[model samples]
Target chain A: AQRVTQPEKLLSVFKGAPVELKCNYSYSGSPELFWYVQYSRQRLQLLLRHISRESIKGFTADLNKGETSFHLKKPFAQEEDSAMYYCALSFTYGSQGNLIFGKGTKLSVKP
Target chain B: DAMVIQNPRYQVTQFGKPVTLSCSQTLNHNVMYWYQQKSSQAPKLLFHYYDKDFNNEADTPDNFQSRRPNTSFCFLDIRSPGLGDAAMYLCATSSHRESYEQYFGPGTRLTVT
Candidate 1:
């Protein structure tokens, strides 16, 4: 079965500290991965995709095929960064398929 | 800014009552999707419409149904909502030409009494 796993339910960090949100996947075929975020009082939006390989809002995620991981990282955290993050695995390798989402991790940045 | 919109951000309905959630998108994307998210759980795909073609998830309950009247709007109808049916219903849209990024609405929080 194809699935996405977010090992941590919550990750708390102080301002200016580095943070990492781990995401792992189990899939028999090539996988298209994504990181989505929901900020307080805001809609859930796409944070980044493995295909893009670009950073957004000081955050970056690298897809490691061997380890089956697409961990999101930020060198320095800010209070405004607190939000719920979900890692998703797409059914199709082409990026258009049912998105299988992980339970999600809540990141809290303390000032 | 053109975006996906969900009506009645918060809805309260009685048990076994029929309720409908509305979603509209101004982006004119080729695909629109509905997801059900229970408390502290990941959002699950309920169904989707890709340019009038409807696709339902294998495990989605029959009590739930959806309709896309046109390119810009979609509706999720719960025929007989039970207590367990309460959840945050999210609406999202994506363009076929655009790389897999989805634009989401604020979502509707449905409460069953």
Candidate 2:
């Protein structure tokens, strides 16, 4: 079975505080992972993928094959960063059309 | 400019009513997908179209069907919507040329009475 799990349903933090949203997956084969964000009154969009390994909006995620984790982290939380974050996994590495998303985490950054 | 578009952002339909939701993408991607998201739940894949080929998820109900008459347009039709069928329907697109990115549209929220 292929599944993605986000442990936190909501993460509340003060502005300028460090934020970490955890994501884990269970799959037998190699997989591609991604982090997607949806802001208030906006559509869901790709934030970053494990393959790129680049920072977006001061956020970063790393895929650890050993632990089957692809946790998203940011040094500081901003008020604008309050939104719903989803962790997704492409079941097959080569056939990348389909995605399996986790139950998202809602981050609330207080001022 | 909006790359992927879904019309009638909010729709209300009566029980057992047939409804259709439309999606269009200007990115000219070769693949398009439809997903159903219940409150606080992950978006579940309903089906997709790679060019003209349609692929439906194994557990997707037969009441839900999709059509893609052209590369840029796709439609999801619910033959008879039940109360449980009300959800946020999202449409996404990807290209074989680019393996990692998927463009999403502002989803349509369906309300069943």
Candidate 3:
């Protein structure tokens, strides 16, 4: 079974402050992790993937296999960064190709 | 823009009434998925279509059914909606079965009275 856990349901940070959202997963096989963001009144969009190793909107996440964690972080938070973030694990084997998502974390960057 | 699209952004259906949510994609993706998300909760996978093949989650209720008439369109049909079924229905598309990135439409909000 594949499970993704997001420990924080809500995180409040002041503008220009550093922020981090925790995420953990349990899967027997190798996992492909991804971070998705949903802004207000917008559809869910892919923020970044572990494999890509790229940063978007000043946010970055690194997958740690030993710890089974993929935490998203940013040096400075902006008011526009306030949104819902979800961590997902992709089941690439057997053509399932479905994403197992975590209970999202709502980030509020107070200006 | 070439992207996934969902119809009837807001839908209201009476309890025990049947309702269908439609989705279409111009991305020419091979995989299409439907997810149900309640307030303050994660989106639950209802089912997906890999081209013409249908895959349903084990815990998905029998009252929920899906149809993919073609590669560009998919539909989620609720046989009888209940109060609990009121939520946002998200439609997503991917280029391949193993593709990591998925394109999502602005989900349809269903309200069951």
lDDT of 1 by residue, B1-113 (tens): 99999998999999999999999999989899999999999999999988999999999999999999999999999999999999999999998688647899999999999
Worst 10 residues of 1 chain B by lDDT: B94-103
Weakest ten-residue segment in model 1 chain A by summed lDDT: A91-100
Per-residue lDDT of B20-64 in model 2, one digit per residue for the tens? 999999999999999999999999999999889899999999999
Name the better of 2 and 3 by DockQ: 2
| Native-referenced Cα lDDT, model 3 | 0.92
Give the per-residue lDDT digits (tens) of candidate 2, residues A19-111. Answer: 999999999998999999999999999999998989999999989999999999999999999999999999857674599999999999999
**lDDT by residue for model 3 (A1-111), tens:** 889999999999999999999999999898889899999999999999888889898999999999999999999999999999999998774345589899899999999
lDDT of 1 by residue, A1-111 (tens): 999999999999999999999999999888899999999999999999988989999999998999999999999999999999999999776645569999999999999
Candidate 1, residue A52: Cα displacement in angstroms equals 0.9
Among the numbered candidates, top DockQ falls to: 1
Q: DockQ for each candidate?
A: 0.75, 0.74, 0.61
Computed on alpha carbons, the lDDT of every model, listed in order, comes to 0.94, 0.94, 0.92
